[model samples]
Target: MQKEYTVTVYTEDRIGITNRITIIFTRRGINITSLTTAETEIPGVYKFIITVMSTREKLDKVVGQIEKLIEIHRAFVHEEDEVVYQELALYKISTKSLESGDIERLIRDHQARILTITADYFVIEKTGHQQELTDFIKKLEPYGLIEYSKSGRVAIVKWSRRFHEHLKELQASSEA
Candidate 1:
């Protein structure tokens, strides 16, 4: 059965690394739903958080191919429940809308914050699960929502003890 999987990849920060990783999925016709990349706790190492819908069998093969890349340190496929994750979304709305009391109530109810207010428009920021962010979008539409964007998933594996140990080993080996 096909289900959503979060593929976490750790790699050395190098040019073309992302292109190489995405090409693996492209060849297999797997559509990446979302992709986030950023530096990790270890300097010079970066992490890619990719979301895709595929069977575990196929995902495993994809991960293997990713691991074969020169700069990749490791690649992991995790079921949704196996990781803790969040997505950030920002909404731009007309400043006029904020004048209404109902809009204030709505924002407060959703626990979203008004990031900036100006004469023309204001920005609202929200951080939550994908569904929660989308739901918030729906509520803001009637209030003159101008634009919106969401970041890809940022996640940490629920069971990361082994991962930490592996990183330590890599550091030790590199220092020798």
Candidate 2:
């Protein structure tokens, strides 16, 4: 049976690394539902959290293939229930089309942050699950949406009290 999986990949920041990683999934016939990449706290390293659908066996193979990439430092699949996840979405609305009262009500109802405002448009930012953002977009579209951007899901497994020990182990292995 196919199950959804989110894999976190840590790799050296180099051109084409993302393409190489995604190509592995494409070759295996797995479609990526969401993929996000950003620089990690460790300088010159990038992290990717990719969401895909596949059986456990296929997911494992994908991770193993990612591990073999020259630029990749580590790759592992995270259990969804064991991780914290969030996504960011930003939408710009035409200020002339919506009344301030209605706009405030919508923002309050959705818990969105007012990012900026000009005479013509208002930019709002919201962060949460993908479903929340989708619903928000639906509600705001009628208000004359100008633009939008979404950061794909990013997640990290909850760390235990012995997290430092695990980090040390990872550092040692990487340095070896």
lDDT of 1 at 54: 92
lDDT of 2 by residue, 1-176 (tens): 88778888888888889899999999999999999889865556677999988887898999999999998877888767867999999999998865656877888888898988899998999999988998899999888898988988988757532543554566678789
lDDT of 1 at 166: 83
lDDT of 1 by residue, 1-176 (tens): 99999999999989999999999999988999999999987777798999999999999999999999989989999999999999999999999896777899998998899999989999999999999999999999999999999999999999977886888778778889
Model 1's alpha-carbon lDDT is 0.92
Give the TM-score (vs. native) of candidate 2.
0.85
What TM-score do all the candidates reach, one by one? 0.95, 0.85
The lDDT values for all models are 0.92, 0.84
Candidate 2: list runs displaced more than 4 Å.
98-100, 160-176
Misplaced by over 4 Å in model 1 are 172-176
Worst 10 residues of 2 by lDDT: 159-168
